[model samples]
Target: MPPRTPAAGSRLMQIGEAAERIGLSIRTIRHYEEAGLIVPSARSEGGFRLYTEPDLERLAVVKRMKPLGFTLDEMRDLLAVLDALATADDEERRTLLDRLGMFHAAAATRVAALRDQLAVAEEFAGTLRARLDHHGSCTT
Candidate 1:
């Protein structure tokens, strides 16, 4: 037989494998699909979502952005804007940049919110530790 193509050697992953590979629940993957963050390139013969490496990479982006406080809608919007810019002509670059500015502003806002939450959580943790230490001294 002739040499096999990479595509033949590495077929698309099923929903379960995709989830496991990305350390996300299958439901989470489905939810991302619903949110338009990731779309499977195709379906398997059994009608299961067939995720390729690009899909997995996309999920990685989604995962990274989420813990950093990006909403699914934001992620979706960002990706859509990126795809548009990437496919746009030079004349359209300016327009795309203007759109990208909106996403950047939103991301900045979310990051600020996360930072505030972190500050509050750190303060609360310190207070709790102080209380625990005080109780320990009283009980000793």
Candidate 2:
């Protein structure tokens, strides 16, 4: 049987499409769901998971956090902060903004570390290329 469409006026998609659109694998999306980082926005009549644009946005956030080496707990906490900010009052918004700032700082530090590692890797590759060039010249 063909896949059932979402209700009229909604743009829900199944797990496979959600994963592709979010640049994640289905298993990764399911893992995030299990970890409470995100949940599908709805389900089809046949019980397949359906996700909305907001759901995919959440997954994109998690995807970004993963490469920065964030733990599941960290991801959950960050997601909570982001969610609360949308509806928070002035005082609550201040606290949530502070939390969000911390996450941003942590991500920046991780990105800088990765750049340093990449620099070292590139230098090593260059060394190897130089050695190969030296050997090739000696053989000629």
Q: Whose TM-score is greatest here? A: 2
Model 2 gets an lDDT of 0.88
Which pairs clash (backbone N, Cα, C closer than 3 Å) in model 2? none
Compose the digit string of candidate 1's lDDT tens values, residues 1-140.
11112365456778999999999999999888877788787776888888878678878878878877777778887777776786898878888899899877877887899899999999999999999999999998
Reference-based TM-score, model 1: 0.78
**Distance from true location, Cα of 91 in model 2, Å:** 0.7
- What is the model-wide C-alpha lDDT for candidate 1? 0.80
The candidate maximizing lDDT is 2
Scored by CA lDDT, what does every candidate get? 0.80, 0.88
Tens digit per residue, CA lDDT, model 2, 1-140: 12234456779889999999888999988888888888787788999999888788888999999989999999999988988899999999999999999999999999999999999999999999999999999999
Q: TM per model? A: 0.78, 0.91
Root-mean-square deviation of each candidate, in angstroms? 5.6, 4.6
